[model samples]
Target: MAPNQDEETLESLLEASKTPEGRSRLAASGAVATTLRHLSASSPLTLPYLRLLRNLCAGEISSQDSFIDLSGPDTLASILLSSAASVEVLRAGIQVLGNVGLAGEVHRAAVWVRFFPDGFLRLARVREREVCDPLCMVIDTCCSGVGGRQRLEELCGTDSGLRILQEIIETALKAGYREEWLEWLLFKACVEEQRFLSLFLTLSSSEESSTNLDISLTSVFKPELLTTQHAFLLDILSKCLTERPKEVTVSGKFALEILEILKMIYNIVDFTTRVNAAIPTGSPAIDLFGCSLLILRDICAWEDARPTETDKDSLVNLLLDEGLLDFVLSRLEELEPPAIVRKSMVKEDNLFPVELEKRVCPYKGYRRDLISVIGNLLHRRKRVQDKVREKQAIPLLLQQCVVDEENPYLREWGLLAVRNLLEGNEDNQKEVAELELKEPITPPEISGLGLKVEVDEATKRAKLVNISG
Candidate 1:
């Protein structure tokens, strides 16, 4: 049969294998062995066909005899090992073997590890354009425990398996692949199954240079990819913090991960610097939306503790340099409450708590540091003025400040920054004055200025007026 016909047959078998009756029929019949034999042949098989057959053999077949009868389970394993199929097919085959749910088959999972040294590494070497989506799907599905937990254990135990996973991470750092995909794969391997947490720990411990991460870092800053991946990386890190907290220690590794994520956001302001960037100017609004959400999430994440001056400066420079201050401001404005006085909104239990808010609330020094960042950006020379339109920039930032003021500390900072802006520039000052004159001005009394001033001024005036009269 042609590879396409084989693929169709495999698909039919897989669909049929979904039911117990179908699975039993597959186990009882010779169809699976025939497919395995065909897969083992020198002739090329479509990736989908190989994947489906692998899945069906592992999942539907219950008896060791079914696999063992194909010249023994070892023979079937040899076919899988030698085929050197695409990562998707290999992963599918491994998963099927795992799904057999027989402890005796654990050795087959181990065989995959022994046979495919750096499976992920080889996959990574392939041009991402050629393999990224398929490889990603392979990682995604394989890590899903589609085969079973024992199978995962078998794979993880293999040195090659661990290396492959590490390669995936390294590739993610270098290739600038989608963080969501990486996160999904990692989460499945480490968090959901707990099979690859040790591998993550080992990789995190290894003294790999940041150079590997630089390409992806640079790519992410590109306007189009930046927003989407930035949000994705943030979500991934946040989930890691919550789900696999133990694997992610409070070491430099964790800090590095956080910093990498922050760099992506910081890079957004200058996304046009590279020659062949992923995110170009005039990208869709969805990109902006993703980028904005990521920034907000990061702000919320670090809202509590005081960031070191170095961290603060780096972040500010990135935001100011990239022209992201306007984007940040815009998000704040969008979150503002309606002017109508309505019932007080109560917090819903189902809603995830904003971890950033809680972290920021207690740290006065941190709040000051954040305020300084906003102030500095408000004053800095615009780097991409032509692209961003300076005339439209300050108002957008001011709107963010106004809207963000719902948090008392953020509100205070926003008001003070606005004050600095309105008072700092002659034009802004005039604008403020004009606006003030148009509206009623209610000034809060300056604290500690004595009522004695009012009394003494009145007495002195009375004395002078009486004498004059």
Candidate 2:
């Protein structure tokens, strides 16, 4: 028969297989075996045949059984392994394989027996959405159930396999494909199994030159891909930290995970600020650092708000014990005063400072994000309040209580932090009252707005009282 005629015939069969009665009839008629018998490299009939078989096997045990019994995987694997398999052909064949694998253990075992490490790894490198999405399905299905744990370990056992998985994630993230499956896979491997650290360890151990893929472990976690390819990762990592069992979250079990996350944040910030000074607007570093801090902030606030708090430590105390407070203070200190304050300084000094151009946390709103974490850490917690006081962060917190064009809501978060610090602590309030205030320096804009900085002589406090009257 002519190729067009053959394709039309297969298309009709595919439509028929969409129904249960048709699927059963097609299975009984040995359609799967017949299709495999005609499978060939560069054949125009290949994709149509695979499509028909995929529709036949989808959610139908009888058709799935026929596909396996007729050595469908063997023929499909050969087509995939061929040098001439078109993207469409690979996509259709992998979809069929995914459907078969989704049936049961016996079906998945048959698929896995044929593909295992190499076949799937080869397909994973395609980077085409049509191929990668179905391939993800195939892997996800095969790695289901208790026995599939071994298959997962084996897939991740080889560096090549791990790189393939990482690239697949990067591809999906960049292209916005099949996020649910990829998210679960990463969550299982990285959080549930702690494969995230393992990936880092592997990268650290291996010579850096061996990272041959478009995305490397370093690129995936660092600022290299942060701008374009880290939304999915940030969301998944945030969920991993935030959605843990409350008990485990507080029991010090999360210490290593928190530390690793803190390390990622520190490294990214360091790389962005020190190694590379040019921060892309809306950089993913903001999302990366912001996500980590938000997780810490929420967890701390949650623990602080609880009426019956666990005595088994806490995420806040654990983080504090890990020097998170010190980290926040250090980063805050490094950030140049926000744009508004900088403007005031430059105008008053009649000179633009070159140091302002090289400010750390250069991305907009970064300082406010840092202050937010501190604000949450201080929420109704006296020990945290005392910790902040002891660390001499009171003055730093006070600085945040001013309008900064770059850091939106900086003044509000700063005020809340100060309130938390002195809510019931007379010592802290008295210390603030006694601390000497610098004579106010009014920038042209503030003077232009009929505003003046007024310091209360009795309390030695500065206030932005309206002098418009």
Candidate 3:
């Protein structure tokens, strides 16, 4: 047909793509195939046809279905990879790819695994802001897909794909566009895929154990490059620390696994400012540390009588080296009163505690969480128990158990921690036997003040008597 007829036909398709019913009718009449043919046959026709496909697939699954039914992506990918393809065609094609990938992971994986080998990744090299950002966004959304990390890593490992990806990440970060998603992708790729978490441990490992790490200067992954990525990671972490996480799971942990991984990246004890910022002033600090302690509790716990080191480097050891136990113990020491007061309402034991259990905890839930973390720490690792005993944790722990007998949760965890301390250790049992509990006696509450009868109508004078309860 003539150029005018081609223009008219492309215009009709573009108009049809704007509506669901129009797209369906175009699909039924094989108009999608006709458009794809025009896309490949006429270089002048590429942008209009690509625009049609992009609009068709934008929020409408049926339009994506119609495009997929015509094998539109392969045609687009082939055109994209061609050296003769114009910059405009490549730009339009990347947007269409993003739209298709957004349809779901299946379409995403197809586009990624096929074109990413050299097509789209190389397209990112284009310096045009319009093209560069859409390319990065396409990769970002694709990385979030089901098999994205694995496939992207495979491609990255083959040649300079990893470098190109890192470059893209750095560019996006410098431009300040969706840095968190970029950080997560980089983290998953490096930490999960490249096993860089071990490398990080080696880097942060204390000076004394430096000899045992066996890390070399000529390592597979360079430290300096990893440091650049880590700097961005730390930036993301600082933000999470300031605001209490809004999403939570049934077990009272952050809902996102990415945040969980970020948790493992660095211990909270070392970053006091960051950890303090993670919770509100009135909110208990226990929730922040409790989650980490719970994970450590699971790691160190044993089913049989024998405990095993689950990893080459124990997370518990990491916590220990970071002084996590000491931090919690010290914080508890700071928050604890000279005397824990239990009301004489229930005469359980002759501990001689104070009149009332003063409001020590900033929030209620923190009480149980703090003790539970400590209790779990004592359960498996004899090292932790030994440390606790050396730190004189028994007397303070016992006080918490008996001081507020009404706090069932605190009492339960405190009791369990005390039990774990004494279960297999005779020394701890003796220490507990020798422990002394004392509660300070406080003055009675002053009830009211009243005028006395000394003003017996003789002198209009008023006398006040103080009443006590």
Number of the predicted model whose TM-score against the real structure is largest? 2
Error of 3 at 201 (Å): 13
**What are the lDDT scores of the predictions, listed in order?**
0.41, 0.66, 0.52
Please give the RMSD to the true structure for each candidate, in Å.
Answer: 16.8, 6.8, 14.2
Give the TM-score (vs. native) of candidate 1.
0.39
Give the TM-score (vs. native) of candidate 3: 0.45
lDDT by residue for model 3 (1-469), tens: 2334577877877887788788667656665556666677247777887887777677667657666767777788777777777768777888888888898877787777666656765675554555656676677677776777777666345334554554454455455553244444444444345533333334333323432224432341332223343344333333433232232111212212223432433332232222222222222223333343343344334333246665422544555665666755765664433222422223453443343433354333344545665776677567887888898776666545533422336656766776676666666655544431223211111011111112113323211223333
lDDT of 1 at 282: 33
- RMSD (Cα, Å) of model 3: 14.2
Reference-based lDDT, residue 204, model 1: 35
Better of 2 and 3 by lDDT: 2
Off by over 4 Å in 1: 1-18, 44-52, 58-112, 127-181, 187-399, 402-469
TM-score against truth, every candidate: 0.39, 0.70, 0.45
lDDT of 1 by residue, 1-469 (tens): 3334655666677787666677677667665566655665244663554554555555453433455455433543454445455555545554444444343434344434433454445654544432444455444544443354544554456555665665655555456564345666655555455443245333433334321222333433444333232233334545555554445423323333333544444433332222122221233222333333333333323222233444444544454445445544443333322111011222452222222222111111222223433444444322322222344443333322322221334544545555444432445444434433442221111111111101122222100011111
Clashes of each: 11, 0, 0
| Backbone steric clashes in candidate 2, count | 0
Per-residue alpha-carbon lDDT of candidate 2 for residues 241-311, written as tens digits (9 for 90 to 100): 56653522333433445445655656656423522222233556555566666556655655345545554
Ten contiguous residues minimizing lDDT sum, candidate 3: 444-453
